[model samples]
Target: MLMGLLWASAAAAEAPSMPGHPEGPMAISSRSMTVKNLDHRIIFDRDVVVKKGDMDLQADRVEVILTAPPNEAAGHALSALPGAGGAMLAEDNVERIEANGRVKVVQGGKTATADQAVYHNADETIVLTGRPETWEDGYRIQGSRITILLKEQRSVVEESRVVIYPDEGSASGGP
Candidate 1:
């Protein structure tokens, strides 16, 4: 069944390090939540919000797919390393995330809005679709699809439209 595959994929997925994100815990709130430990997936619906560090994502629904922890042998080896137990545990989980219906993400001074957004933790890439738009630093970009590389601080937009606003003094056109 499709459900089974989704669950299996979650366990096998890998999470990449996210830049500009603190190592603190992630908090999520929603009108309703469904957690399936066996499937390694969590679904939140209705006014869902996920917050971690300085970033917040809001949407009508959100799905989180978690990765499996390292094997016992690997865990033992990792435990031998200095300061590796807890931090490594966190880094090895949380494979992918999906937000749907009026998804909005805000981080620092940047904001992105879309009907749906899928974040691949393994690659630190976020793909936004359905009227995707992003705004930051007096510039706005909208496109059919937008891909953001979190660690690189770069965005690629397909079939895009861009607008840049001039500063007040520059817009005066006196000199």
Candidate 2:
């Protein structure tokens, strides 16, 4: 009886953990799912789809990487589940993010698609490449090679041929 009770308690304690769900976002793969925890309250899922107000983020895998401002008060310090650290969220400190397989991020009428993507919390940006494409604000950009310039809030494409889809009533250049 004691053994059974102990097992039950352990299960209960781990129920909300990222591994426990495996059904959450961190481990989702169209069949299985996992949730990556960030600061306890903030959790992101792998192979997940998220909608935030006017933005949408979708990916095959996800992670949480955040850093508390040193100047911030201790009470505001955020902590993640024990043993659930070290997952790189981005090129730097990232927090509760998703990636894997194919990643797509849409924000403020801009859409970006890539084979891999990483969201950075410290700089509030996402870096994606592997044939990335970005469309937004009256312009559409695509390239066999691309980089999302989060800091400049623009996309830089390399070795890419750009074709601006002409609108109606626009005259074609004379031959």
- Residues 50-75, model 1: lDDT tens digits: 76666777899887776743233234
Tell me how far the alpha carbon of residue 50 in candidate 2 is from the true structure, in angstroms, after superposition: 2.3
Determine which window of 10 residues in candidate 1 has minimal summed lDDT. 1-10
Candidate 2 per-residue lDDT, tens place, 3-23, comes to 000000112211121101011
User: Top model by lDDT, which number?
Assistant: 1
What is the Å distance of residue 85 in model 1 from its true position? 28
Best TM-score among the predictions, by candidate number: 1
Runs in model 2 with CA error above 4 Å? 1-47, 68-98, 136-139, 168-175
Query: Lowest summed-lDDT stretch of 10 residues in model 2?
Result: 1-10
